[model samples]
Structure formats: C-alpha cells, structure tokens
Target: MDIHDHNRRAWDRAAAAGERWSAPVSPEVIAAARRGDWAIRLTPDRDVPREWFGDLAGARVLGLASGGGQQCPVLAAAGARVVSFDASEGQLARDREVAEREGLELELVRGDMADLGVFEDGGFDLVWHPVSNVFAPDVLPVWRECQRVLRPGGRLLAGFMSPAYYLFDFERAMATGECVAIHPAPYSDLHSLDAAAREKLVAAGELLEYGHSLEDQIGGQLRAGFRLEAFFDDHWSGGPEALDALMPTSHATLARKPEAAT
Candidate 1:
C-alpha cells in the first residue's frame, strides 16, 4: 500500500482518539517516563536530566512526529528553542492551543516523517525522536534525514519500544515462540506492522498501530550517522507488578555525530 495513504489514515485515527489529547501517562500498561522514581530501572543521565538546562538554553532542538507537542513544552521550559513536526493537523492544533494557554511557544510543522527538507542542513543542535518511529514500517529514510539536518557533533535522542515486548504478547504464543526472534542484542528492523494488526491496536485503544525493538531503536540511529553514547532501558512503572508487567518497554538512546567524520 502507498505510504502516504497510510499516514493520512493514521492522522485521522489519532485525531479522533480521545487518548492522545487527554493524559500525560496512560493509566494502563504504561507509566510516565518524564516522571517516576529511579532504581526499578535506570536513572536519567546527569546530562539528560529534565531539570534546568544550562546546556539546552538557546540550542535548537527538533521533535520528530512530535504528537500533541508534549515534549515541546519540556524543551521550551528548559530554555531550548524547539520546532516540532507532525502529520496531523488536528493534533498540531491541539498542541498550539496548549502552548498558547501555557504561554509557551513551539513551531509546529506539518509534514510526513519520511521527508524533512523543510529544515536546513546542520541546523539543529539536538534531534528528538520519541515513541514516534514505531509508526513507521520503515525508519531508515526518516533517520537519514535526521542525520542530514543535525550539525556535526550534534546529538540524537531516541525513545523507542523495546523488542522484549513481543515475547510476552500472544503473538509469540501463536507462533509457538518462533516470533520470539524479534528481540535480540545489537539489532535493526523490528517486525513490520500489517494493517490488520494496526486495526486491532486501534480497537485496543492504542493510537499507534505498531511497536519496535531495540535493534530498530538503536541501530537505526547509528545507520543515520549517529554514534551510540548511552542507553537507558526503562522498566520503571509507577504501579505494582501487574500493570507494571505490561508497562511500556523502551530504550532512551543518546548518540552523536563526529565533528570530522564524512
């Protein structure tokens, strides 16, 4: 199927879904990442702390597929200048209203993730990709452009679903565990999401139709000219082990481009 049609449908679904506009963290199968205690999992890097940003002040940051402009406020609050892009006009409009009410500002661009030439080369100091790429059956093209627009020595931060998620889900049980191969150390493309699975997820209250693994998470960044720096595996959910067990699985990766590498 054509990718544009896929995204257009996605935009429609996400806008009508009450979940995206309503909460900071889902009450089920997920915990807040920007919140929560340290130690059930990894702590934020001293550098990536959500607090005051002596570092991000005046630095330009790009938020990819920045739905609802959630992180845009965090970046702007920290003093980083931010530009966010999303395919959904309704979602962006909701974000703009929130920003206006909060007295914060974010530049919202409407575009498909696959093409980002609206921004210049070496333009941003930081590129933020969070919980967004899972929508892409393919992440390489989007990532390549992310690399292109990042200045030499700039940073790329990615928050993506971990491959481990597939193991516990019934997808593995039906395959008699053969589907378990989706998660592995040092990897790339997670399983692709067909439209049926997408529909099921939407029915299940998930705004997104797919999930990705560590390989797709970390490897894609590297392939886009980013060198892996640090990785955080979040197992920290605010609730007890039941919902916590199904809590989102993810890796927060920090990568950088070498100032002199071609």
Candidate 2:
C-alpha cells in the first residue's frame, strides 16, 4: 500500500470526523493575533516562544504539513505572507475555510511534505511544522526539503513525538494503562503490526503512524544543515493517560539555516 495516499485518506477522514487537530481556529483567535496577542503550538500544549518567530511582519512563512487552519491563519494575521502545504485535501479545506471567513490571504498547496519541489529554493524565511511528521515514513527527505526551501538564516520550527513514545503497546496502554514495551524505535504501523491488526486500523480509517528516532527527527535537521537553537518537551493530553503523566511524549525544536558567507 502507498503510505502517502493511505495517510492522506486517513487524514481526510480525521478532518471529516472533527479530530481535534482538524478544528480550525476561531475568528477571535485571528483577531487577537492581529493585535499581537497570538500564540501557536508546535507541540500539544506549550506555546512556541514568540522570540522564535521574531517579527512575523512580512516574513515569508511556510506552514509545512501544517494545514487544518491552525497555525497558518494566525501567522497570516500576524502579518506574515503564509503558504500552507499539506497532503490531505480535507486539511487544506479547513485552512481555506478559515481564510475565507477571516478575510485572510493564504496560499494553500497539497502534496507530500517530503517533496516540496513546488516551492522555489530559498523561497521562505520560516517553516512552521507541527507534530505531523509521524505520518511520514521517511523524514530525512522532509528535512532536506525544508532546508532547501529556507533562505540562509531562516528558521525551521518543528515538533515531533519522542521516539520512546512508540515503545509501548498503545492499544493496551489506552485500554488497560499497561505500558508494555512491545515495539522498538523507528516503528511503522505497516511493518510493526501484524496483518490482522493493521487491517483493523485501516478498516477503522485510523492514521498509520511511524515512530521516527531522534537521529531522524533532530539529527536529520542538522544533517540537512540546520543549526539547533532551542528545544522543549510537551505532553499529549489525548495519548495514553499513564504515559502522559509519566513523561513528555513529544518535543519542539528551533533550528536555523546558517547565513551565507559575505
């Protein structure tokens, strides 16, 4: 099965089902953003530091894999020229819904995150990516594409699940709160789950996730020429309750492409 196409359909179902991430931001939120009182998250709970964005006024921002009308609209309200790119048409529709309602201008593009060839090289000043990379089977290409599209000294703000979060049997933990370590890092629902289990997930229209390691999540950015600047941890309120209380299951990072030599 094609992971990208399958995940796209899964996310479309998720949007239609009113998944929390699929919910669009309110007009009030956009109003606050215009008044310089806006905050957005890369992780689940913690707001990304405002300093990370500096003055968004006129900044060329790419909302990478970030549709569903959450971050991009707010950034646009904050004066950034924003483009939102995602694979799911439903997700992009939410962004458009908000854009139309709030009178915000947004460039919405739908495609695989790893293949950002639609965007020109050094075309953006910032890439705001939330915790959606888990849906991608490979992240190195995504990182490379992010680096390529960013101007020198541009920032890449990204969030992702902690590698260890996938070690447990999530189904068992959610039902019984028993965090049985059944999987390893770099896990994939396609290869990690048995045929019966995988079929059940697909039948239910659930997202097929990948557990990418730190080497691919963080180190991949460095390998792609981003310099790590700041980082933070956040917990998912919707995740297994036992594990959510134990430790942070996700992280956000601030990395920058090096300035060109004079």
Candidate 3:
C-alpha cells in the first residue's frame, strides 16, 4: 500500500473511541428507525423502511461490533434472539444496564469483529451491519465471515455513506474547483456526523473509510453472495428532500443473500 493508504489505515484503526459517531439508541430509532433518526433524515419513510420485529422476527441476529445494544434492545424486545458484540467494555456495560431495565435479554460479548472464533458457523440468520462495516481494513473479509455464519437465504443489512455526502464535506468546494480534500475520511469508511465532530474524531486518530460510490458498495455485497433487493438515496434520516446532486449522496442500497447459489 502507498503511504496515504498506510496512514489512513493507521488512523482508522485508531478511531475506536468514535465518540458520538454511533448515536445513542432510544425508543424512536428501534420501532421505525428508518423514519426516526439521522439515518433516514434525507429520504422518504418508504425510502428506507424497516421494522425491528417484522423484518427480524425470529431471526437470530449477531450485531457486528454492535455498540451499547443500539439495535439489540429493540430486536430483543421484538422476539429476536440477539447477540451484541463490541470491543468497548464501557459501551457494553451501558448496554447491559439498558437491557436489564427494559426487561430485555441480550447476550453481550466483547471482542473484535474480524475474529468470531467463539461462535459456531451458520449460527446466525442476520448480521446487522449499520455504519460499522467500514471499520475493517478490507470489508470483504468481514462480509465473507458474515456469509459463513448465516444460514442460506440469510440477510446482511448494512448502511453506509453515499458519495454525495462529500458535497457536505466539500460544501465550499463548489465555489472553487480547487476541491480541497477538506477532511481526512478513511479510504472506505463513512464518518457521518457534523463536520466539527468528525474533525475531532480525526484529530484523535480516527480516519474515515468511505466507499465513496454506490457501485462499489453493491459490488461488495454481490461478490459476497448477497442479492440486491432495494436501494434508497437518503439525504438524511426522515427529513426534507435531499436536492444535492453533485455525488448522488444518499443511502445507496438494501441487499439480501440469495437462497440459491448462482
């Protein structure tokens, strides 16, 4: 890898303390998160629709590097047997308390997402990959594992940043073709938060890994055996229309694993 890629990788691995990047979970995000949070702000309700219980009902889910029971609390409430894992002890502790208070049961584990040596193969039906897939150096390795752990026809629902979001990063660039790579977004990860906070994380050694293109995002899923089901161009979570056209920045796609091998 070149020096830029090497520097980016180092910076990315160092962003574990992603302070505020993963928003604190609450009731609204669980019931109809597509309509609730920052994720769906730029799109329509039907654009990125989902229900924790309806879609994940009876589905054994392994939230990949899931922090603070963010999606765990709701899925568990909805009757899905869910396992939450993360490398952060403090985050898991907070999740444990929430699980207990909510009368929900969540199996919380602390470890890395790259190595799930503790769990058996084909042990889960779903791997929730919201905003976390970019953490790995090469996402395919992780996607391959997600495929291994899933039963045939299982789904991997992942959310990532759209390319158009760069417009926000380069909001001022339109004025001058000078296109300053204003932010140090990691090569393939998405740092979706206010600019100031994003820079703060970067300064603390956090680098963003933005796939930067919808085609690349979908290609990863297809190569890993997931069939593209649907896609949304979300400007923000449950908000006004996203009229920015520079990079077509929106939540790009929704995909599922095919039941039959191609």
Per TM-score, the best of the predicted structures is 2
RMSD of 3: 7.1
Q: Is candidate 1 or candidate 2 better by lDDT?
A: 2
Winner on lDDT between 2 and 3 is 2
* Ranking, lDDT, top scorer first: 2, 1, 3
Q: For residues 100-187, write the lDDT of model 1, one tens digit per residue.
A: 7556667899888878989999999988776566567667787788889988988877666665554343455344423234434323
Best by lDDT: 2
Worst 10 residues of 2 by lDDT: 177-186
Between candidates 1 and 3, which one is better according to TM-score? 1
Cα error, candidate 2, residue 238 (Å) = 1.7
lDDT of 3 by residue, 96-127 (tens): 76577666778998766666788887888877
**What is the TM-score ranking, best to worst?**
2, 1, 3
What is the C-alpha local distance difference test score of each model?
Answer: 0.60, 0.93, 0.57
What TM-score should be assigned to candidate 3? 0.65
